[model samples]
Target chain A: MDEVRNVIELKDVTKDYGDFKLDRVSFAVPEGTVCGFIGQNGAGKPTTINLILDVISRDAGEITLFGQSVDRNSAALREDVGVVFDEMGFHEFMTGRDINIMMKNIYRNWDEAAFFENLRTFSLPSKKKCGAFSRGMRMKLQIAVALSHHAKLLIMDEPTSGLDPIVRNEMIGIFREFVMEEDHTILLSSHITGDLERIADEVVFINGGRIVLTGNKDEILEKHGILKCKKEDLPGISESLIVSSEVSSFGAQALINDRASAEKLYPGAVIEQAALEEIMIGYVNGKR
Target chain B: MKGLILKDLMCLKKQLTTFVYVMAGTVVISILYVLSTRYGNLARVGEQLLDQNNGMSRVDVKNLGSEAMVLFMFLPIVCVGDLMNVFVADGKAGFYKVSSSLPVPLYKRVLARFLTIYTLFGLGVLVDALLAVLLCSMTDIMSLGQFLGVIFSGASILSIYSALMILYCVLLGYGREQYAQVLALLTMAAAFVIIKFDSVRFFVVHVLGDGVGFDSSVFWKPLDFIREKGYVLLGIAALVSVCSYLLSVRIAERKRGVI
Candidate 1:
């Protein structure tokens, strides 16, 4: 069997801004997997993204893209990396044609035909100024630009945040199409866990500038369980297995780290598998 | 880098359109001014002034038309070349966030902005030079060499201002291009005062403080300086641009800064 390659990797990355810091962040995104970077607002998500893109300098630690250290002024590495932000960064007055003209000169492998074809497929008018575009249209335009240059890695920050469900589904379909190519990978950062649960092969959870949990999506969801019991029986559950517990008038509900162990140990208690959102909440609540 | 330059040019679209209209207006007015010097209202004004003998000469009358032509020449340059607008537009649109992610390196990004300013300045100079040729053909007040000198001087001066503004834009960061413009002007003024302290002191102490005789040649001094000393200004502009580029590259590399 061939060893899997990490398309993007950060080893103990750190960026300090006095009020907040990305404290020793480490994660490796394997090639061809969609790694959902789930974090709440002000959880250092954007800052980490900025550091990975080299839009801002990191205080310490190593960031490697495509196996090369990023600190070596590795802008050349971005030729194969595509990025999409929450906002449309293109000038309001710029048309699709204007963007094509500008980008064709920037990227060495920029394909004019594919770019316009993306515009046509996305239903974005080539001659119309992008300022007239709706929020969904703006996001689509950004996606079109990201896809046009044949990038291998797509790093999108909240690409589906504000869009209607239909548009979000459409974007998901586009992302699915992108990842269908065996070598293509995506690192999507968003607080929306539903989107991640639908598509992510791997999940990296971050909170308060720290890596909360990271692993294969299925394993994380499978290992975690919501075990509910009466208040009197709560202490009987092993201390190590309970991630966090909540008490109500009727019973006690605990999020267990090891679902199989909890089920084997307490066969009478109602134990159900956890969703990604529940797992994320359990970890966050456990931290708090 | 060429792509970034094209983006900046896109930012200047409205200004360039305004420049076209201004250029057209200047051309029509300048041609009329040229014709008026020989056979129109300006000729009558010159005759009337000569008859009155209010101590102004035919040469001074001709200099009036030259001064008017000079104003026309500077207007187009002003319309087309303002490095601040590009920064302002970038700040407004948050383009640096996208540009910073592009494969182009930081130093190249800085250079592209500097190149955009010069591209506009070059366009302004070329158009002005062509206009100069036409005006020189129709008038005897100023030679083609003199007009070209002033054009070069004006471009070089704007280049210095522009170079300083780009440095300030990088130094100050985004959403502060207005401050960059003011700071650039203030810096230029401070530098001028520092370099010409003796001349400034002489003018203040002798011309204003002591109420020394007012010389009529003071009116012609600016035109003479711009026409005769353009190459020196060009040299200074080049030096400032190189210094600004180096400094901007340093700041950008250190801060991962505004482009």
Candidate 2:
């Protein structure tokens, strides 16, 4: 692995919560690339991010952020990494200006002018208390803070979960600009696959606490295809190659991992490109 | 650290206003009671302690001081509320994780909260002392030395109480509404028991009012005993503060995801 080029890397990370276990997982986000962490509600995306942040301890395996072991240099590593949670985590009584002042004290690289400019860009009120802000506004404030600090790496957990389409589109553009700088990178986790498809360079899909797929977004979409065939032709398809299959009175639809191989084997079947959502659903169903 | 302290102080300003109002009310009532009983006509008493049969005699200056101390207990309770407010506010706003995740050490954060609460408590005590002195000057009942002693004693006791409150707030983790109600009930019960039982009265006297010439020697004797034992109590309070801080740090480190 090219460790030098990788900003965040997790190797065989495992966290056990008695009844629920985050199984051995491995993935890496290359420097200057956006890695989309795709998973369902209980797919352990938050758990993995938590482990990487050292917010929660893992049972086994090593995590390296900024080319240093997380445990050995967590405080220093955190200085350069900006994190945004799905929910806004700030005192309701504090205004955006108050937050800027407080955060400036924490991060030596925190720029007040940049923070205020971003707040203006996001159209957030500087003096209004956070409690008065709507959900979209709160998320924008969080992002504004995350970007104002000169953090080299950004880790966001479902930052756009409930945002309106327009705000989501705007945020996606901001994220694109964020990674334009050579040293900056982002690892974004969200259940919304459509946004990931539009922004992510690499896609890592997790299901039931395990990594089901990891590859380039375009490559994964290009290789995986949905085959629509008659019910009688379903038996002709090999179960080993089908990730998942939906049966109906009219026909059977199956998701195949390798379109080229499936096409060679089943010449009569109709194949179409599968969206990221379809691929996620097929992998989560574990039909293969 | 400066920013954290400023934030804490800004959040506490409203509660500080309430404390000032309560202290002012206490001083006004004390002045009214003194005037109604002892010095209704300041011209009548000429080197003689006014005596009355089956009615209020010249109010015992020491007993008056003890009453003043009782009034000041609210200051510490209010200070405790200030400390607890930080936790409750953060918990309500979902900001605990955000603040804890900062590079600043958890101990420093806890210390900042403590300093804010105690500094406010100190200011409350100063206001109470000023009010008491003003009331005493109007009543012509106590000397400057005696007034200063009462203020110093009241502040010392408040410091210990504020420390205990900080420890309690940390242990409870913002789930203190029920605990607070139960504690109020227990305090009322204890007050009733002490008032009704002569033995308990005697114990209170021996502990708080040994040398203080108060009509209710029962209350001041035990307080005097407590004052004598102030170092030990203060030590315990300091130890509790340190332990609670360490426990809070451990909790912060173990927390995963968001709270």
Candidate 3:
């Protein structure tokens, strides 16, 4: 494999909010890779995004994007980056045309033709008020704006959260297309593990503002498994082999970190490949 | 900066449109009122001069001159109101959070806001001056000097008002609606209390109260004070305005994290 350049790198980034702290969190997103930033509600995904955008100040640590410090490069680099929040960040009265005009003034690289093309492709009316847009349409509009500026990176927070599966699949397809250039990247924060499972090249799981897992998606999936065994065998299974387990009246099912090792230790147990959702759940449950 | 101002203008489009129509209507009404009543006032003045023995030489035309001064005072208020509305609109749309991700610098954003308010206020002053001239010409109540003095005094006071309002908004931080409301109430109460002070009373009365409009004896005092200390006062106002702007930018920079 060719050595990949990191588009985003955070080393010991910390932000203290008195009540909640992003405790020395660290991760990196390589160029051209779709990094899935997985976290539960209030788990600091938004905080991390905000910090990267220089919207919020961090207490300690370094965050470099596009090979430069955010503090110095935020303004210049923003021309090449696109951001979409969970909520549409435009005023209610503005139309798609109004946004285009405003963005034309804001971004030097803004492409009016691309924006209009996106509007046509997304079936959005240019004259209608965005306040009246459906959730799916709003997300599409944000995507259009994000893509129109010739952005090298797309930082999306819950971009597919409330969309229907059809819309989500379409959005995912669009993202796949965006990354085909091999220089474009995306840092998508979402709760939908299934979406990440399909599109993510790298997965970074954050729980309580701490990174629990960060690795290539396939390898992370390959290393974890769910072991089903009789209740009597649960006590015999070593604690080191079990990540987390659920015990029921009939039997026990435990998530194991190393499938081969678990298989060697529990010969009678049945082991199954763990999905992203199962792995996340196992890690979260085990952490608690 | 231009983009930020454009966004602010778009946010204020409805309010600004209504204001334009209202000002246009006011201009039409003033023209009609001046045309209709000027001849009547002239006839009354003619009769007064003819019956000069009665010792009532001139009836106070009391025309729209005072009303024009009132309008000048209201201009700064409108500017302040519009400025606040822009903040509120931005808050509602979460524009600050969104803007941070944009390529514009923080100071540029703040400068854009200040420039918008100042531009509107400048336009307001010009319109008020034109209206004052028209009203004075039709009524012959106030001399040109007196009209200019009233407008100048009103603008001076209102400039200070606007600067303080901007400072309040900046220091209070963005989207703090409840705190802003409380501060407004406190400011109103403070205004009422401060008026009791001798210096403040002199200043307020000269600029806004009966001293300028109704009391002829103290009428020229404001004009005289302005003539003697006009440059100094304007200098002070400019200095304060600059300080207020710089402080506002600093506050905005510090609070951007919270926003």
Candidate 4:
């Protein structure tokens, strides 16, 4: 078997905006995996994405894409990288054909046939102005542009936000098809944990400009559990195990980071597997 | 880099359509004025201005047609030559995010904008040159060289203004294009006043004083300078554009992601 190679790497990356700072952020996404960059709004998600793309200057540390420093020939390295932002960044007057024309000149590997085909696959009208497109259609147009080029890596910041479920699912299907190739990778950043939960092979959780948790998705989900017990019994549980807890009229529940340890410590306590949403919320609440 | 220029042109599509209209108008007006001076109502006016024997010379009186044509041509070459709309359109669309993500170096990105100014000016000058050849062939209003010289002078001046505007646009960022335009004009005006302060003061005190008469040299001297020395303006425009492009590239690279 071949040794797994990382597609994207950030080592001690730091960007300070005075009010909020991404503090020495470090993470890696191996090839052939969808790494869900989970964070709430204003949780340094877009900033991190911008830094990775070399769109913004960083105060400290380094970023590497395709095993090369972003500072050196960063523009050339983007030949294989496809980027999507939450809001459509294209001009309103531009049609799908217009984008294809502009992008064909910009990217060395731009496939004109593939671009129109992607438009067809997404049901986006080739002649209609993008300004007339609905929010969902606008996103689809961006995705179509991203996929038209033979890009090996996709970096998206909140691409699925504000879309209807059906459209979001359709986008997920497109992303799934993209990752079917062994070398393709996606670093999808969004607050929608459900979408990430359904497709992400790895997860990197961030809160308040800091990486709070990260690892394999299955391992993270398997390790975290919601422990339900009486308010009186909650005090007996180790503080190390409780990520966060809330007490109610009838009982108290705690988000236990070490579910197995909690289980061994209290045999009477009822523990249920925590969803990605529960884990995210528990971690966010724990931060506050 | 070609892609970025194409995108900027797309943003300026409205200006392009308007440019065509202005070109057609300049041609129509120049032809109509030439015909009027030769056989129509303007002929009578020219004869009277010459007959009255004012402080104006026969050369000055004869240049009335050329002066009108130069002013008319200035409308297209100077006022219509702005690339400010591109910045406004880019800002409104938030294209900075998209442009920054492309596989283009920041210096090339800045060069594309500077090149756009020349592209528009090139088109304008080309059309004006063709028109000049046609019009000067049939009439004595102005020689072809003089017409081209004046047109190029206008283009060079506007290019300088546009070059400054590009620098200001990058420094100030979006939603402030109006300020950039004003600052460019002010900078040009300050440079002119600083460079030719003595000439300006002499003209004000000796030419335009209360008892002083209308000095036809006031008008004809500058026209002669523009006709004979327009290359100076072109050289200055090139120098200003080079400086602006270098500074814009540095600022844009430092700011990172701003167009």
Determine which window of 10 residues in candidate 4 chain A has minimal summed lDDT: A72-81
For candidate 3, write residues A256-285 as lDDT tens digits: 999888878778789999999999899999
Best-first order by TM-score: 4, 1, 3, 2
Cα lDDT for residue A269, model 3? Answer: 84
lDDT of 2: 0.74
lDDT of 4 by residue, B1-259 (tens): 8888888888888888888888888889888888888898998887888788775566886766778878866777764578888898889888899888889888888999988778888888888888889889878878888888898899999999999999999999988999999999999999998999997777878777753745677768778878778899999999999999999988998887679
User: What is residue A54's positional error in candidate 2, in angstroms?
Assistant: 2.0
lDDT of 4: 0.89
Give lDDT per model, in order: 0.90, 0.74, 0.79, 0.89
- Give the higher-DockQ candidate: 2 or 3: 3
Give the alpha carbon lDDT tens digit for every residue of B1-259 in model 1.
9999999999999899999999999999889988987899888988898899788888777777778877878888888888777888898888988898899989899999999999999999999999999999988978999888888888988999999999988999988888989998999999989998987787778777876845546567777778678898999999999999999999988878477
Candidate 3 global lDDT: 0.79
* lDDT at position A286, candidate 2: 61
Off by over 4 Å in 4: B211-214
Provide TM-scores for the models. Answer: 0.97, 0.83, 0.87, 0.98
Give chain B TM-scores in order: 0.93, 0.63, 0.68, 0.95
Best prediction by lDDT: 1
**Residue pairs with clashing backbones, model 3:** none
lDDT per residue (tens digit) for residues A1-288 in model 4 = 998899889989999989999999999999999999998888999999999889898999888998999995789988989999998989999999889889999999999999999999999999999999999998889889989889999999889999999999999999999999999999999999999999999999989999999899999999999999998988988999999999999999999999888889888889999999999999999989
Q: Tell me the tens digit of each residue's lDDT in model 1 across A1-288.
A: 989999899999999999998999999999999999998889989998888888899989999998888775567988898899999999999999999999999998898999999999999999999999999999999989999999999999999999999999999999999999999999999999999999999999999999989999999999999999999999999999988899999999999999988889999999998988888888888889
Instruction: Name the candidate that leads on TM-score.
Output: 4
lDDT string, candidate 2, A1-288, tens digits = 744488888899999998888899999888988999999998899889878877778999999997899884675678888888888988788899889878887787889999999999999999999889988899889889888888888889999999999989999998999999989999999999999999999999998899989978999999999999999898889887789999999999999999999999988889999999999999877633
